[model samples]
Target: MVLFLYSPLVSRGVAQSPLGAPRATLAAPAEASFAVGQQLDANLAAATAPLLAQGPSSGSIVTYIAMLSSQNVVPNAPMTEARGVVGAALAGDRLVVRGSFRELSSALRDYATDPVDPPNPNITSAFHIHRGSPSENGPFQYALEVTMNSTGRGGSATGDYRLTPEQIQALQNGLLYVDLHTTRNRGGELRGILMPA
Candidate 1:
């Protein structure tokens, strides 16, 4: 019976918290939300086009943040209870989606440019993906998993999420993105938005 309101960056600039909104169970239709250059969509293609057009902005990181939510349902499990990872990567030009693990898995990433020197390496993080969801109780909502890397595999330093070389290339060229990888019948889904970490 809680309600959460959002400005949706694309909608307006209202920085309000979307905490208590109705959700749907996997038993219901699965919905997805995506973030492109400026528009959000329910379709995957709508999310990829923007990346292709702007190649991660050279030594820069861009994130197509996806928010998955449900309608009329409550959460029966913890965010960690879900099995497997629910996202993909497109190396430079290739597109990959829905990589799995077990239940539902979430991931975040930071994209940095290749270092140029020892002092101020040219390689620096262009973008970052941080897990924004709180670890508390609430209705089912979209859990963010996976992030794009501009630097190919082996170029990463911190550990949490990993991307293949191909995936890194794809992200650099605006090809990689995260998608739903849930195996349950929950109603909440993913909504994406391209923004700064």
Candidate 2:
């Protein structure tokens, strides 16, 4: 009679029987290991590949830069030496505006000699993207509105205005312009056309 005994160690690739007799150990399958390595390499390549090479994807970001000047204001303000840069970006559902001013008057005075009080002191001014030229009157549509920082030098604002596809096209076509309004000049203190950056 032949007696056969099974050992856990032998099943796990050990080269010895339960009675300590030598046996040939089985090697791990090389093809299976190579397949695992190939799968890992493919996953890594997919993760690092660029999504967009030509331009931004839909709902991606579009940026514009504006050079602000009082001379561009509708009804043009007095030739003050105030000038600034206003940057805007549309990303997803949000619109962001950032700006910095130099040689700007912080006083609560308008273009006229009259001294006026601002409704909100923290907001030194207001910025807007208008549908028409800064000089155009009536039926003005605001594309975006941002409150100036309290420092009167610069600030930023962001909002979810859900810009429409037509609005985005208008922005790209130069049909949009930035208008800045201060306590003194309610219509606009500074103005500039938006252009791609």
Candidate 1's TM-score? 0.21
Tens digit of per-residue lDDT, candidate 2, span 32-104: 2222222222222221122112234434555555667887776656555556555555554344555544444
Please report the candidate that would top lDDT against the real structure: 2
Clashing pairs in 2: 110-184
Model 1: per-residue Cα lDDT over 15-93, one tens digit each: 1121233322233223221112112222222333333455545222233333332221123332443222222223233
Per-residue lDDT, model 2, residue 8, is 21
Total backbone collisions for each predicted model: 61, 1
Evaluate residue 125 in candidate 2 and report its C-alpha lDDT on the 0 to 100 scale: 28
RMSD of each: 16.6, 26.1
Q: How close is every model to the real structure, measured as TM-score? A: 0.21, 0.50
Model 1: lDDT equals 0.28
